[model samples]
Target: MSTSPPPLTLEADAVTRITRWVAVGALLALIALCLAWELWLAPTGRRTLVIKVLPLLLPLAGLLKHRLYTYRWVSLLVWLYCAEGLVRATSEPAPGATLAMIEIALCLVLFAACAVQVRWRLQRAKAAAALG
Candidate 1:
């Protein structure tokens, strides 16, 4: 007879659900901020900079679906925005610098949400396995 490991159930408790919503909200805010900053609030010489928002769009579907892999990868992905925000906040002036600061804040929130959701989910799964 062949033996197989039990299937893992990914359930969202209240905290996990809240974290997921927070992640989604932060992500949407980041996307909107990127668009407004590049196109309206402070446009660079080349509008091409707006392309930076593309990668942010990639995680939307996965996030909405609450995929664990998406949360894991997005936690790593948010750092790039943080770096960009840090660089711009230091180099740019006035509204651009302010916008960068906002970006940094949103990135931090998003990262925190992803990290919390992933940790909680994994812990829950481990506990379930133990009990099962």
Candidate 2:
């Protein structure tokens, strides 16, 4: 009579939940900062459509719904933002450069959270399938 230990399903659930919230928060912060930076902070005096922040809104609904597929895709998508932030941070002027650095931080946090959530959720699904 061999019996295996029960899976740590609860721990996985908690981790997935925490990571999902973190990703959501980071995304929201990034959006807000982008809007504020573009609309107010910079000395650019000329008002332009805050197109830079619009792309992030595309995944907002899916992320709020806790869609694992969205998490996977957004994780990959954030790298583009990271690259843009890196470039702007180095070349853009003072406040703009500072905002770009903040963008980089937020993007990295969001990407890491999404990646961990996806991995944890996938592993949980696999474990559930194996247990049946």
Instruction: Write down the TM-score of every candidate.
Output: 0.91, 0.88
Give the per-residue lDDT digits (tens) of candidate 1, residues 46-128. Answer: 87899999999999999999899999999999999999999999999999999999999999999999999999889877866
Query: TM-score winner among the candidates?
Result: 1
By lDDT, who's the top model here? 1
Each candidate's lDDT (Cα)? 0.93, 0.87
Model 1: residues with Cα > 4 Å off, grouped in runs: 1-12
True-structure RMSD for candidate 1: 4.1
Residues 12-113, model 2: lDDT tens digits: 779988998999999999899878987888735565647877889999999999999999999998999899889989999998899889999999999999
Report the Cα lDDT for residue 48, model 2. Answer: 68
> What lDDT is obtained when candidate 1 is compared to the true structure?
0.93
Report residue 40 deviation for candidate 1 (angstroms): 0.4
Looking at candidate 1, the ten consecutive residues that score lowest on lDDT are: 1-10
